[model samples]
Target: MSRISNGQLVIAFLACRLSSEMITIPGEMVSYGFDRFAVILFAKLIAALLYLPVIFITLKFKGDSVITAAFRRNRAFGITAGIIMSVLLSATAVQTVLSVQRYVTDTLLNNIVTISGIAVITASAVYGAVKGLSAVTRSSVFAAAVFGLLIFLIGVTMWDKVEPDYLYFSFINDRSHFLKTLISEISMNSEILIFAVITDELRSKPYKTVIYYLPILLILMEFLNMLYNLILGPYMTKVEYPLYIIASLSDIVLFQRLDGIDAIVWLMCGIIKAALLIYCIGRIYTVCSNKPHTTLAVAVSGFLIFMLCVILGSDAGVYERMTKIMNSGIHILLGGVVVPLVVLIAGRTKQRGRVKKNDENI
Candidate 1:
């Protein structure tokens, strides 16, 4: 894969985050007032802080990833880094597949988004991974545009149904609930791990991407959270997909309803996210073997994700438990903080040795 523009990265990551948000599985708060509003806000702030090491190490190498840089310094170090990141990315892909499956099975109102959604999506993700990030990035632009339009239409239509009384804060009195939700939000920011791996390899460093992606995501989350609270009020907790429920009411003159549009856009985003994870995994394979058979990586990733979803069936509780175990705060800390710091130290140590050798020879 070739290097891509920062703008592409921004849209791709944004799409992935949007997709993750659209498919909130079990274990996430059902309703419980506006605590999620604060959760989204503070969780992202903390995720950004946690992800600083990764951002720093990636940019530090100029054109190479920290893993690649470290591998050049020591083969073992590089392979270890590759293995660690591969696990994290694989877990993320599996989690995404499970979430999509869960959302479909739980919300059976729409035949457009079918029970076979995971298989179709996995196939598309493999194809996209083979096509590479550039292709996925282009698709995300369209998905984002569709999603933005849907949000606009929903907001306009549901303005009358807004109830400000449901917008009360509750995280203050609920410390344990607040922390659990915060960790989940941070864990859901898998795009951070995606960004760290993909950008620096063959592309420009992601200085502008991070700046644009996070605030946009935070603002969008806040808007959607507020919209959920306003339109559904206390009743949102009863259903699985709040966006789908709200989209059912998006009845304007030109169109009938937008629930189908909503489902398609998020399904598109989920594919984009999965393809990205597969693509990044392939990139890591290149780093490990110095061979670039990304197609093999993509194929293996798609197959595994499909099988996992199939084996797990459509059990929301089981998928949620597995994902929670796989993508906890500890995993985030290891991927975003601990692993990057190790790669950085390896790269810097190698650089210092090179300098020392040059000086001694001189």
Candidate 2:
């Protein structure tokens, strides 16, 4: 496998973090009566704070992949983390696939035309994973370029229409709701797990990557939220894809409409995110089994996730239950908090043992 640059890795990371949520986040924020602009910016601040521990852990490992480093410290702990992360990422993949299907079917095509949207996305993700991280990383760069262009066009075309006064901040009276959204959104922004998973394949420095990439991601997220608030205001809650709706109103000279461009960006980013999730699962499978199972893992994982979407079968209750579980920071607690803490403890224990041995020898 070829080593990928930090820029490409960050692009892939941002693609996974930014795409699907672009549509739902605005609505989610509006429904909870949180200021759309402030909440997104707030979420990034919270995410950066929460991610400090992970950053410290990554620095400790230096050139090692976090997963491999954990295994060297304690195999059992590493395996546990892998299992937890695999499950968490798989659950996320299912939601992503569903979101992509919903958006494409709703905006670009009819039900009959997009009946196989789920299958196509799953297949594409599997193929990307099978091709390996290098391919996916390069593809993310292309996706990011497209995303950048789309963002530029939106900002330029919509500038005259933006309402600066609408960019308001307010403390929601519903404390519980506000806290939940805050925690969930922060956890949602923890796309660092992907970096940890593929640490070995990346050519960039971890500390620098985190420092440079996160602020940009946060700023882009803030801009999008501000755009939504400026154009749609409180009415954004009524729309399914407010950002896409805003894009549709763009009046660039060459492209009179930008919704299709917006959809393509979302679709491509969604697929990249799904592929990265599958790739992460495949990495864990390789670690646990002590063999490369990339092919088998991607196929089986994609199929299982697709089956899950099918089994749930448009049931609102089931979807809500799944969403609640995924969004409740359980993944963050288990994969981000618990597993890393355990690994850190194990590393300390092993280091102490080595130091004791040296003292006794002396």
Candidate 3:
């Protein structure tokens, strides 16, 4: 099968990571501080630093996928890592489904509308995954182009309304709160895991992936934060969907509002994100079990994830899961730290054995 190019993966990855932030994160930023822009910038800096292990993992397993490398080096360790990854990817997929459903129902459309929307979204994702990573990557590139154009239009339309004075910095008064929020923001980034798994799929060097990704992600985030604070000012934190509200306020000549277009873009991006997770799980399963169940695995996983969305989309359940995921260090610990460490150790051990055998032959 053809592999996804680095450009395609990066575009898809960015769409997945940034789509949720367009609406949800801007509001949460307000609760942290009046200088939420500065706080977010700082938090992003922290996240960049924290992404080092992922970079290392990527570099270490550049020519092969993490799962392939693990299995080649050590089967026991491969099984352990595979199990950990399956659980983590499943959780991530479920959350993505639930969150997307919630966003559609609460912000974009009615409950009735959400049913059709859910069906279309889930079906599209499964189809994309079944088509393979290359197909998803191409679709993501197209989605990214459209999404970028829409974002550019919004920026141009809203440029005049932005106030430079709103970009003020203030000391973080609550140290504990700052720390907690910083950690939460960092942990919210599961895109790194996608990078780890897709190392072999990438045609480019692994280190280049992080180099290309983080700066763009950080800059986009900073731009959105600034835009939110500049236009919304004191009212930024008061709204539930600040980005949507911002888009609604944009009045172009022929187009009275861009909110509808923005809604579609968000949904498309969300599906790409969810489907990418499903694909990752399928890839890991296929490699670990030494079976070619890619299409079936993705279909079954997508179905289960959609069911999870229905079950977990309730207020209390979503709040519980979201809180646990955002606040917990499990993602960072397992995906970021432990998985990479295992790969590194296994790789080194295999290399050393080769060296010893060569020396004995000499």
**Which candidate wins on lDDT?**
1
- Per-candidate TM-score against the hidden true structure: 0.91, 0.91, 0.90
- The clash numbers for all candidates, in the given order, read 1, 0, 0
Report the Cα lDDT for residue 89, model 3. 76
| TM-score of predicted structure 3 | 0.90
lDDT at 253 for candidate 3?
A: 78
- Candidate 3 per-residue lDDT over residues 290-361, each given as its tens digit: 897567888888888777656665456665766566546577568766787778777888889999999999
lDDT per residue (tens digit) for residues 87-120 in model 2: 7778778878887877788888766333388889
Better of 1 and 2 by lDDT: 1
Superposed model 1: Cα runs more than 4 Å off: 25-27, 30-32, 108-116, 169-171, 201-203, 314-317, 355-362
Superposition TM-score, candidate 1 onto the true structure: 0.91
User: Which wins on TM-score, candidate 2 or candidate 3?
Assistant: 2
Runs in model 3 lying further than 4 Å from the true structure: 23-27, 31-34, 113-118, 327-329, 353-362
Report the error of model 3 at residue 264, Å.
1.2
- Order by lDDT, highest first: 1, 2, 3
Query: What are the clashing pairs of model 2?
Result: none
Give candidate 3's error at residue 260 in angstroms: 0.6
Q: What are the per-residue Cα lDDT tens digits for candidate 1 across 123-158?
A: 988999999878889999999899889988887887
